[model samples]
Target: MTPGTRIEHDAFGPVEVPAERYWGAQTQRALAVFTIGTEYFPPCLLHAFGLQKMAAARANLRCGALDAERADAIERAAAELSRGRFDADFPLTIWQTGSGTQTNMNANEVVANRANELLGQPRGGKSPVHPNDHVNASQSSNDSFPTVMHIAATLEIQQRLLPALAVLRDSLADRTQAFRGVVKIARTHLMDAVPMTVDQAFDAFTRQVDLGMERVAGTLPRLRVLPQGGTAAGTGLNAPPGFDTAFCEELSRLTATAFVPNPSKFEGMGVHDALVEASGALNTLASSLIKMANDLRLLGSGPRCGLGELRIPDDGLTSSIMPGKRNPTIAEVLVQAGLQVMGNHVTVTMANASGNFELNVAKPLLIHNLLQSIRVLADAVRVFALRLVAGLELNHERLAANVENALLAVTVLNPVLGYDRVAAIVREALASNRGPREAAVSLGLISAEDYDRHVDAAAMAAPHGLSALRQEPSGTSGRG
Candidate 1:
């Protein structure tokens, strides 16, 4: 079939597709039916598929299934695909295909046909370099799918997600230092409780993100172990004796990733615990992101009506009906993405648990959901930190006003005035609509200047203030 020539096909019913279309009739049909949504198969998984084909070709060569020339052809083709050569051919349409067989065949055919072209053979011609025998030797769809999934996830984490998380961590660190001098009223149950610096709040957020990144890093070692040797079942029945380790070694060398062989073939083929654990790590990160994003939203709530401790940038009009209204749209998107990632984690967990002895048939959905989660989280973390958290401004005046109205002022007055006196003054101040400083002065418990000097917001924002507060006896000197 030459360019601009239409060939009548039995399967496709004479509809004209592109002359260079690599996928077959079934994939084209599925593509037409599943075009209802914008959700397309991500490119990361395709790259992983290409890597898997390359590894399979190496495994075949080591196992004597193909000569060096044929292996070189398949490898060269796979490398081209991995370098993002044949992207347009891999149109995203496997969503409607139940078993993902269409996608598997699509990958096989594309790489094989390309290999044939490179070897100066006719397209789709099975010769010394056959798609199944040379390209897919010693592998089943069951093993190949999950292997590629692991490769995709590991690459995404290392190349994109972890780096984005590091950016977020550094942003929070900078904000922590920037807000170190600003004192704000801390809240519990949405009511004022204690005094803390904005730096402390940002530090807490940074800690959550740091711990989540650590957890993600911890899962990488386990995820690097692959089950390539388990051909169809847990038994390496068709695999050459030493092909397992050699193939893995070759893959590691080719991809520059630590691709190790699975120690126990049974567990590798039977379950997807590695993927489950990876998803769990992602779930941990999602949980942290939800908490941090929600806190940011609440802290930056309103300039006039809410806490107003921090100011987030207003990106757009929040409402169509209301005038001069802005909302935390970035935070909302981060929170929603976190929720979706959590749901994806749950789906992965259930799918992992439901796998039978020899295979986990839920890999298509698992890879789909997991990769989506990773991409959303990586992009969200980057956008949220750069656009919202990094650019946030502390509303120092509002914070001071809230602190003056808070009952926690008694905490500062308890050292100079006894605890009982401070408690009484707090009650009287609340009842008489007077500030704590005024109540202390009216009762002659402390001079107004002395009260101001002792409870200095700037001094109290320091780490030394927390140390001093910790040393003071509980009921004796609540003042630091």
Candidate 2:
């Protein structure tokens, strides 16, 4: 053996594992060959692996597949692993195996070794608690890895993503109430269209975020269906009868989350359609977030030269060359994060579709991208809510100015002056560089009193007498 390495034997031959590391022969071999990427599985996934191992051990003990003493040692070691005690022992990157077999084995070996150490045995000695026979009892990398994927995804979405989104939604709802009376010019096709309150725009964003929460929640049912007892190509070949249901029940008790055995373990291991469906939901959310972020960028465009409808919260971020230049840094960051999530959706979609007969060869990549999407998007949303939406201010002066000068408010005058007459008024207003009211007054179109009575910009934002005017036959339809 090498100076600092200890000999561990697998089916292939003797291998030298680092003496200080708890991983065994297979992990050492994987570390040597799969030198590819820097992207390791997230801590949440590792924690999920430990949880799965612990649950499996409990089930195996109940099924009489493991002795009570070994099971006790495994439960202790795995519980510690789940709490992040053995994080350093799991160093394999996501690029190693498609089914995450290497990572699964890595977890097994670590738990076994740790359990042995706790039972007065040396590390790397598979005695009293063989990694596969005990720690991985009634499980295969195929079923267990996918189950871990589901557990990790569900926990992250439930515990992290939804709460962060709710924070943003509540902030937006508060803004909605705050801006209810502040009317502004609305735009369509990048042109001034009519009047709308600032609260209306904020309310629309609140609805989008609410629906995003709903969409993310919609994916949980499918994710909670676990494929754990389908050992070796979804056959349940080596797993004891009733192991699937018992394992899920134990996992649910451990995590306080509802999980059930998949009805068809073959489909669960073979296709990964549930993950694809989840990616679709996330893609929709990304699109909504992008829309909201870009709108913030546009609405808060400039204090002098651009729209200037909304004022962004200044966080001390400024351009290097331009003094006193406060950019919409939070909006920009949010948009970039949303774009990355959208891109991750594409990778997930393709990876899911590439699955072959018995198992998808894209498990590691799919979970990596999905979990990354959840993490970054959740953090960005929290930042957006705290640093941007919570501190957002309306540019009241600009909003009033734009609403006062809006030409499309003349649509409210259509019943008083027919569409053709109103069209001429619009053209004349533009040609003569005059306000619509002024243009109508110059043309002897109507008395200024009537113009003021009919053209209240704030009232035009909601239902007024316009519909009644259009319906009443006694309406003034004059061209003279």
Candidate 3:
């Protein structure tokens, strides 16, 4: 026998497992076979496995599939696992089986060994509580893994992602209200076009975040529909009748989240459309974050040479060569995170599409990508809001400078001077490198007093002189 290991038997043969660990033969086999990646399933998914195992044990007990003694032991062990007590025992990597069967067996073995220890038996013997027959009663890896995926993802979105998004949205909303009267030059095609309030820009960002929350929330109903009763295949071969409903009820009670059995176990087991839909929503949210982050970076680009319309908060990260230069580190982090979420969505979509007849063979990769996307996005959004958006300061001098220098503000005088006259004044101003007022006065098109009175930059930002502009001939539309 190996000095630091003990012998544990499965259908293959006696296998050597670490003496101090609780996992048995199948887990040890998985550890040796799947040496591909350093990534393991996240703690959330592990906790979800625990919760599902516990709920399944209780449902089995209610259905007369397991005796009270074994069921109680499993429930206790699984509840501990749910609370992260046996985290070390779950050592399988996410790269193991496509069905995540090895991880499921890993959980079963851990729960069984721990339950046996609670019953005053040795850990590796699988006595008094066999890993498969007792600990995993009325369940199969096929059904259990997907159930855990749904549970973990739903909890993550509800507890982490949604709250972070709400906080970000609220922060932007506060900015919108705070800067309502602050006007700045608005650009289209990277050229100054007209004037717009800072609040209007912030309002658009806030609405994007708000709509992202709604989009994510819209996918929850599909996630709550689980396929726990489909064991081995979608035939409910080993699971008891009503086990799906009973398990969902128990799981809902334990998690305080509503869950229901899928109307068709075959469909649920065969495809991951719910997860795909959820990922699509997350992708949409990531796109919005990308746009917001890019806008913030541009708006806060420079204090000396760039836009400089808004001042980004100092994140304590400076450029290596540029002394005393503060970069938009937080916005950059958010943008990178959003980009990663987009890439992970692509992986998830491909993984979900790999489902074969009665089971999707890409279960582990799908859940792993989805969970990673959720975790990174939640963290980035929260930090971006708290560290950057809340501390953003407007550069009033810069806003005024940009607004006063913008030639598009001359469009407001179109109704008074006519298009050709305004066009001539704009061309003269640009050609002479002088202000539009000077150009108009020199061109004898208007006096400086009349130009100032007609060209109200801030008033042009909203509906001003709309009636006069619309009073043109019925067939003639005003030109900018």
Question: How much RMSD separates candidate 3 from the native structure?
Answer: 2.4
> Given candidate 1, what's the lDDT at residue 384?
91
Per-residue lDDT of model 1, residues 1-480, tens digit only: 557533423243744445576544445555676785555568888888888888878877877877899888988888887887877778765354433555766677678778888878755455556656667777766666667778888999899999999999999999999987677877889777667788888899899989999999888987888877877776776778877787788889877988898887667766878888988999989988998999999888887887677889878656889888889999899999899999999988887776776777677777788888899999999999898888888887888788767777567655566678888888888889998878878977767776776776556656655335533335543343
User: Where's the lowest-lDDT run of ten residues in candidate 1?
Assistant: 5-14
Error of 1 at 418 (Å): 5.7
What tens-digit string does per-residue lDDT give for candidate 2 at 162-259?
Answer: 99999999999999998997998888998999788899899999999999999999999999999999988988998888899889999999999999
A best-first ranking of the candidates according to their TM-score comes to 2, 3, 1
Global CA lDDT of candidate 2, please?
A: 0.90
Candidate 3: worst-modelled 10 consecutive residues by lDDT:
469-478
lDDT of 1 at 425: 83
> 322 in model 1: Cα distance from truth in Å?
3.6
Alpha-carbon lDDT, every model:
0.77, 0.90, 0.90
Against the true structure, candidate 1 reaches a TM-score of 0.87
* Predicted structure 2, TM vs. truth: 0.97
Higher-scoring candidate on lDDT, 1 or 2? 2
- Among all windows of 10 consecutive residues in model 2, the one with the lowest summed lDDT is 464-473
